[model samples]
Target: MTAAPALAPAALRVRGVTKSFGDLAVLRGVDLEVARGSILALLGSNGAGKTTLVRILATLLAADAGTAEVDGHDVAAEAPQVRESLSLTGQFAAVDEVLTGRENLILVARLRHLPRPAAVADAMLERFALTAAGRRRAGTYSGGMRRRLDIAMSLVGDPPVIVLDEPTTGLDPQSRLEVWRTIRELATGGTTVLLTTQHLDEAEQLADRIAILHEGRIVHTGTLAELRALLPAAPVEMVQKQPSLEDVFLALIGHDGPPATAPSGPTAQETAS
Candidate 1:
């Protein structure tokens, strides 16, 4: 019998991975894959082990069983290789506060052993819209500016894959939107982005595919539209001159439906019909 053709290397592949902390199991036979240049958003409620899964992929934590590959490098055996091929941007900005934005970038470039560190730093400062503030201490920069610098630092080596854990947590609305745009551009430029976020809207906007984890296991995983299809559409509240039942409901209850719009909630008559 002829052997099956070899499968193409995935940007990231986690197979039956399990992790435990004493009596608690953080990851239970979890399996996931992210294709090259695509965005995968891992969503979960608190304590669902989203961060644990990310840590495992980033080689910051070991799994009790199974294996994972990042950019064709085994996460457990080839951890250094996996670390070299991937970048991790955590919830807090990791840039050096005492260093100027340019200095921070240069430091990272030097660590990555990029030729002409100053030139690379200059280019990155421009790319991240930080040229004006490149000479200023990162400690003095605004939240958005600091976050941008942190992300820019992560790009010093131009790694193929980036794992972001809540890259936009405390930023204002406009700043959050800006970060979203940056993520889009990165994916467009052939970077595989795997991020974890609590923002449903962010996932809806940025994720090519989303996996919702519940209790350390994947409860839902699909394109946003597919996930939406699984859940009924909520009521459409309209502003009109005449009052209707929906209007009365809104006036009395202050919402057309529950404040938390869940996928399994009842569908609006208009949408259900």
Candidate 2:
């Protein structure tokens, strides 16, 4: 009989991840896993330590306690390997304003020592639908175009995992939707994406799984349906309701209606226990 094959490890893994500043604890024993080729959204409010957790995962900050691994490499002990396996696009677009979009990508590819950087850069520009704008300086690009270039730069390394920190925070509605489509395409193309977002609707539209971080810990981790299940069952009623302005706007823009249902079970604060 043939021996069974071993399963691949998760794209990202964290155990007992803790971080603090002086007397205040920002993260209290957080743990999570992101499967390969899946999208995981880390949902949190302001000052909920979402950014801090992302920084640690990207190897920008050291966790006071606990271990994190990316593509099977320990983040602390094998920083270079971890870096090689993941790319990070922070809240703000990080492209060089003076360089053309194409030049920015080529510069990143060359820095990563990729052969044929020009070819790689062109491919990325085309992939992100920035081919027309590729020749223009990043400083002249619109917010959406610059954001796409920023993400394209991250992909120049061809990393298996990508970390996006509130990527659409300040974008207009149309720009935000464009970025959302781009993110969905990334996951569909076999990239593991871990995104932090304050927008519940964004999480609902993009994530395969959602993890809620409150105070410091993940209070919930599941799909939209599972999260909805946590709420108390509503009584049957027959009532006609008119559509709200938000619903009309969503329909106009071809957006799916509504964010996740409100959770009446233990709140994130209650679930911290």
- For every model shown, what is its TM-score relative to the native structure? 0.84, 0.88
Encode model 2's per-residue lDDT on 19-65: one tens digit a residue. 99999999999999999999999999998999999899889999999
> Residue by residue across 85-200, what tens digits does model 1's lDDT show?
99999999998999999999989988888899999999999988889999999999988788888888888889999998999989864456567778988999999999899988
Candidate 1 regions exceeding 4 Å error are: 1-8, 232-273
Whole-model lDDT values for every prediction: 0.85, 0.89
Q: How close is candidate 1 to the true structure, as a TM-score?
A: 0.84
- Tell me model 1's lDDT, rounded to 2 decimals: 0.85
| Candidate topping lDDT | 2
Weakest 10 consecutive residues of candidate 1 by summed lDDT = 256-265
- For model 2 the TM-score comes to 0.88
